[model samples]
Structure formats: structure tokens, C-alpha cells
Target: MHDLEGVDRGVNPQKTSVSALALQLEELLVSSDRRGMAQVRQLWTPGYLHTAAELFVRHCQRVVIVSGFPVGETYETDGPAGAIALLQGVKDCGGQARLVGFTPYIDRLRNCVAGLPQLNQRDLLALDRSGDVCEQLQGYMAGFAPTLLIFVAVPGQAADGCYYNPRFEDISDRTLPWEKLLELADCYSIAIADSGNHLGMGRVADPLARLSIVPAVSWTDGLVIADIANWGACGLLALASAFVRKNLLRNLHLTPLLEVLSRSGIVDSVTGMATASEDGLPAFSGEAVVTTLRNAAQTLQSGF
Candidate 1:
């Protein structure tokens, strides 16, 4: 969902007609330049929401979703929200979703799942460094035969062959090289992220590097960029709900999700502190995003 300013300039009208709910959801999720770092980049395209939604419905069945970015010394408050939301979205669409994360953060991931049973996602995975992580994932894929592989807020490898956090600092040892799993031919890949450091941002590495937000290149078949990674996933759910007209995301409650995660040691990625927030947004910001997303779904459901 690269937010390109002029993607609709000469494209097919039907393919480029982004719905109002999708547009409003995009606006609410774009980074507000909070750090004054001016690093919040909008790498989206017209009809991204529709395109991703169509992909979700037409081709995805058993899906593998990966998240869990360690901000400083622990898992942060960004990835899980998006991952959980997407898991619920997938299940609501008659698909099965399996959650994967580093072993260090598996407990936190479990906490998120246990606290939100309404999402009905129970398949959680732990990527231990004891063996080849990619091989294990390939084995899992062989068994599950997923149709889509989605990475949300997962770090991407840089030119230095190491994973870097948002500050351009190295974090390779703590992250799994899960991007390598994309080599599997059985499924298409979609990445949801807010910055260039994410696994999917490799598709636009040059633009991100020019802005100095990304230092290395990585790629994914489909990319969804947003202000907060979770918000992008929520937008996808909204689009899916509209497409199926079944409220696929009705059970997603962002505030309670954040609070559960906060108590479970999920810190704010931006502040690097344990707070019930995403990136560095306050509680109300999370509330506003969830409200806007629900409103968008309501609008679409009402056939407006």
C-alpha cells in the first residue's frame, strides 16, 4: 500500500477508484511527523486498500503472519496489534492464520492471544535460533500449505547484512531472517509496515534511503505502508468487510488490545517504553484510529 501521490493519474478508472472509507482510513493512519525527524513517509498508491482486499479474498486461505519488533530490549507495541487484527480478518474471511514471532517474544504474543479470544486465533509459533529458522518455517508451510505470507512490522535486512531498528542501529541477532521464507513459491507475500526498516519496504529501498529512513533493500510481492503498521492492517480488514459485507472486523477492539499488550510488556516502539500506545501515539490516538476504522466500516456497510 505504497501511498503514491499520483498513482491514479492515468490508470484504469475501475482499478484506481479507491473508496472513501479507504481514503479516510489512510489519512488517519499516516504518520503525523511526531518526532520532527520528518521521517514519516507516505509510500502508498491509489486503490491499495481495494487491491489488497481483493488479494485477501481471491487467493488467500491458510496464511502465515509475522510480527514482533523489539524496540530496545523488549517487544514493542506495534507489530502484535497489526498481526492480531490481520489474524482476525483472515479468520473472518474463512481463512486460517498462524502467528509467528521470535522465541523471546512468544510469551507476549501468547498473552495477546489469550487476552483477545474474541479474535479466535490460537495458532502461535516461536522461531528459536537453535536451528535454521527458515527451514522450520518451510517445514511448517509444507504442512499448512498457506496461500499467503504476511509480515507486519518485521525488520528487514540492510545492505550491511544486519537488521536495523528505526534508529538505524543493528538488531540482527535478535531478529529472525524470516524474509528468506518468501522464496517459497506456494504463496504470495504482503508486508505491512510504517518505515523503511520493515521487511516489505525493500520494494522501495531507494526512495527510503534517499530520505535516510532505510539503509538496505528488501522486497515483498505486496506492500502496505502506513503511519502505524497496525492501522494499515485495520484498513485491510475494513476493505475486506466492505468487500464481503460481513463485518469481518467486528470483534477487533484496539484499546483493550493495547491495554492487554501493555500489561504483557509490549512497549511503545517510538518511546521505547511500556505504554498502551503504538509507535509513540497516546491512548487517544489509538482510540481515534480504531473509531475511524469502525466508522469507515459502518459507512461502507450502510452502503454509503
Candidate 2:
């Protein structure tokens, strides 16, 4: 097990070639820096660095929660809120979880759940309309040293009936693409988990592409993905599930998932010990969903 005690704060320059990337991102945060913007254009994709910085700062000290649309639904649900729910679940199990919301959606979620307890709103760096998700993720991982990250995809309508936007193709063209998101998992030593597949949005190419990037041991069928039909939603769940499976529950370097679960009151069901598989993967019908979720949540809490 890797000892997380006394882990250094800030990015390890040797671990990632991100110093140059950081300068470009810093310029974007500074408004009215026309020269900086020009310089950014020559060295990297415009707005890409900014988006990555936003994601990094937002996820700095916490686990990531992502939600989104699936294949069948018209307007599946709010991705940010679903992410929040997962975070809350972690907190409920005595875990420390941070909720990272993508700009406009974050604001909308705040308005939607005005009086909810354990839901404090914080600003994640913006990636709005920049048209580059990969750059955003790269900048985020460079800036924030989060051990776990969850990504959710919301479902919405496209010109051809209902479909998820921001597919892998939409984000992969940039310099640091979806492949980098997975790389961060390996680099930072974070676990990546996802929920089950759904019809609404989980079928998108980006989520699948992300799944392909990570070690298969780190991936899993996430919650919303299993319930919904949209590929976008499924992709988000996959990201979250992967984080939980890899970083939280299964990593021997960190606290054991069983210890967290026992503390969270999820280890023993009415029948007996909760006979769950690693990372909550299938093959064990004896485990209860509530217990499994609680166990996952407890693991997040222990990460902090």
C-alpha cells in the first residue's frame, strides 16, 4: 500500500510537464491580456488551458462527481445535482467529498436545491463554450491533486431526436485529450470508478473512450449509467464509478474499503456480512445496493 501520509502539496513538476502549460493557463485567467491570449494561441489551443485550470482548482481537495444524460430520455436530469448526491452519500458515510460543477450547470443546480444540507456551493474554474474538454481536464489535473474524480454526462436533445452532446470526438481533437484524463489517474495515483450503463447518454464515444484509456481494473458500471438509457449519462457514471473503484475502494495504499464500510454501518446487512466483490463489481448477489453505496461513500471519506 502506498503511504499517503505527508504527501506533498502542489504539482510535482517532475511527474508532469505542466509548468509551461500552467503559464498559458494563468494568462487566460487574467482578463484583458491580449498579448497573453496571443501567446496562448501559438503554444496551445485557445481557452483549453483556462478550462483545464478551472477543472483542476475545482477538484483540488476533493473527489469528483459527474452526472449527465443517457440515451432514451428527453431531458434525463441535471448532471451537477446527481454528482452532488454522490458526494453527499460519501459525506454521510463520514467521508470528505468535493463537488465540482461545470459553470452554468453549477449555478442551475444551486438554484434547484436551495436549502439542502451538506451542499455548499463553490466555484470550479469555467469551461463554458470553450469547445475543448480535454484541455480543461489536463489543466485541472495539473493544478488540483485530487485523488478521486467523478465525471457525469447529462442527457439533452440534438437535431436528430434526443442525443448527448460533447461526445469523445468533440473533445479529443485538442492537444491534451480524453486520453490525458486517464493518464492523470495513473499519474496522481487516484482511483477512477463509474456507475452502470443507461440508455439516455452512457453510450457516447467520449465516455467509452475514457473507459478504454484507464486500466480495466479501475473501471466499473456506475449507478446512473445502469439505470438510464442515455450514453451521455452512462459516460458520466462510468467516470464516477471508475474513481470509486480504483482510488477509494480497492487501492491498498489507502485505507481499506472494509474498514470505512464498517465504520459507516454498511458492512453487515440483516442477513450477515455484506458479501461484496471488489469495487462493487457484480458476481455477488448477496450484497445490498444501499450497503454497496455506503461502502463506496465511506471509502471516499477515508481518502481525506
Candidate 1 lands at a TM-score of 0.86
Q: How high is the lDDT of residue 6 in model 2?
A: 16
Model 1 C-alpha lDDT per residue in residues 29-74, reported as the tens digit of each score: 5635432112433443545556667777775688888998886668
lDDT of 2 by residue, 1-304 (tens): 1111211212122333333323322232222221122232334333333233233333435555443332121112323333444455355334455554344434444543334444565533334446667667666756665555555433222223323233312221111122234455432212111221211222233433333221112221221222111111222221233234322222111122233322322222112333222222221211222223333324333332
Write down the lDDT of every candidate, Cα atoms only: 0.71, 0.32
What's the alpha carbon RMSD for model 1?
Answer: 5.1
What is the alpha-carbon lDDT of model 2 when measured against the actual structure?
0.32
Candidate 1 residue pairs in backbone clash: 1-223, 1-224, 2-43, 2-44, 2-45, 3-43, 3-44, 4-44, 202-218
Q: Please list the residue runs of candidate 2 whose C-alpha ends up more than 4 Å from where it truly belongs after superposition.
A: 1-61, 70-75, 78-81, 92-96, 123-126, 153-180, 185-225, 228-304
lDDT of 1: 0.71
Residue-level error in angstroms, candidate 1, position 23: 4.0
* Cα lDDT, model 1, residue 31: 38
